[model samples]
Target: MVKNLYMLPEGLPEPVEDGACDHLQGLALPSVTRPATSGGSVDLSELPGTAVVFFYPMTGKPEQPPMRGWNKIPGARGCTTQCCGFRDRYPEFQALGVSVYGVSAQPLADQKEAVERLRLPYPLLNDTDLKLAEALELPLFDYDGHRYIKRITLLVEGGVIRQVYYPVFPPHLNPTDVLAQLRS
Candidate 1:
């Protein structure tokens, strides 16, 4: 049911292929500029070439009501795996002229902490409001006593979604899966 809702219409939409993820996905992400830890909500519509945006969950605190318990998500494992997978194989994507980026609801402080802790070479965007995730209309889990972004990956080209992955086991996101898709 969810997958069907997210399926592309045969191929990329003309307007999106014109350099936007707007038609392929929806207007949500295209209109919202998520404040990156580096400062700014990058316009996904103008993204050049192929790129990957990974979304995760966060539990913000008062001062930074957007800075608490982000790593608490189960999706973090899958996220980390996918992130490192990309990092390890980053050169491959670059060689192929693809850009790679990661997004999460964690605050910049927390994101920086994780990046430093993991020693990742790439920058991670902070999407604590879950706005980015919501903009994409991605499945979100909230019940019992937890809230987290379902592990998801988007293969975007010229700002349009070439492919999307959901129900991805964050802790064990098969890099090969992404590799094969990206290679395709």
Candidate 2:
């Protein structure tokens, strides 16, 4: 498929400056809803308590640098590791009284398939249209000259981003962060 205009015709405009989500800690993310894995829609926003949003690069395609994602490198160890980490520690997150969801620019089909492939118990938000990405002003890159999502995490509550995590390297590395958000 051809790239969209959002790309400087092929890539997003370089980020002017990183936002609060980059350095924020202890910020409470709000609940959000996207099309459900079962198809149609589900609204997590109505769920109670604080919410954590996991921002993952598209989990489809092989680790192809041409796809663009973490390290701006194709096929970088991105989604699987971090997500599995979350999966393993999901109970802990649950006890914290916070809901968690995964977000990506990939289409709904991809997100749904990923939920099944990973057997994720939570919902995945499809930001494929990129409205959410644009609002966040994410520092997108062209890997092997192709655009893809950045690897980051957001902690939000009540429609506000309380904390953001970048370079969530070493997947599944969940430290019991009492902070509002733990990206890594």
Candidate 3:
């Protein structure tokens, strides 16, 4: 049976807030250029106006099984669902004058595949080098010899982080939560 990549399994562990992102609020984005699925690269710090950047560990492909004990990790699952949620709500974000970007440590090729497969309107920034993660001190975890960023969302305005959403539970609802904050 093919696992549904867009659905989260029942009883998935919820991540607890660890204050990892507390220092991010009101922080200026660093000048780091990351390759994007849309081609070339984007410097989040140079972007004008409002933007939302959601960081997830990694997205699983249809053909491949997820890493061992993937779902057991508190916040490791649901990347695909999270991305799809953002994709489905892209129009709303655009209408609100906010740009959306997803970042992961995945390579650009993998990100491109996900963009084409998921029909994502916004680009997924490649953070394979962890440049942005290092600069911001984003939460990270190691699994199967690979390092992954924890799920977190940032509301950026004028190159500054205005809001930080850590421990985003039920990843699919994250977009809704962000929209609510943006609307308020």
Output the number of the lDDT-best candidate.
3
**How many backbone clashes can be found in candidate 2?**
18
RMSD of each: 11.0, 8.1, 0.8
Model 2, which residues run further than 4 Å from truth?
1-33, 42-48, 61-76, 144-146, 174-184
- Residue range 123-176, candidate 3, lDDT tens digits: 999999998999999999999999999999999999999989999999999999
User: What TM-scores do the predictions have?
Assistant: 0.67, 0.66, 0.98
Q: What are the Cα lDDT values of the candidates?
A: 0.57, 0.57, 0.95
* lDDT, candidate 3, at 14: 97
lDDT of 2 by residue, 123-144 (tens): 7777766555555565555555
Q: In model 1, which regions exceed 4 Å deviation?
A: 1-29, 38-40, 58-76, 143-146, 170-173
Looking at model 3, residue 64 earns an lDDT score of 86
TM-score leader: 3
- Rank order by TM-score, top first? 3, 1, 2
* Tens-digit per-residue lDDT, 1-184, candidate 1: 1221111223221111112223444232365665554456576667887787766453222233322333343443334556667677777777777776777765678777666655566667766677767767666666335555665667787777777665455323445577788776
User: Which 10 residues in a row give candidate 1 its minimum summed lDDT?
Assistant: 1-10
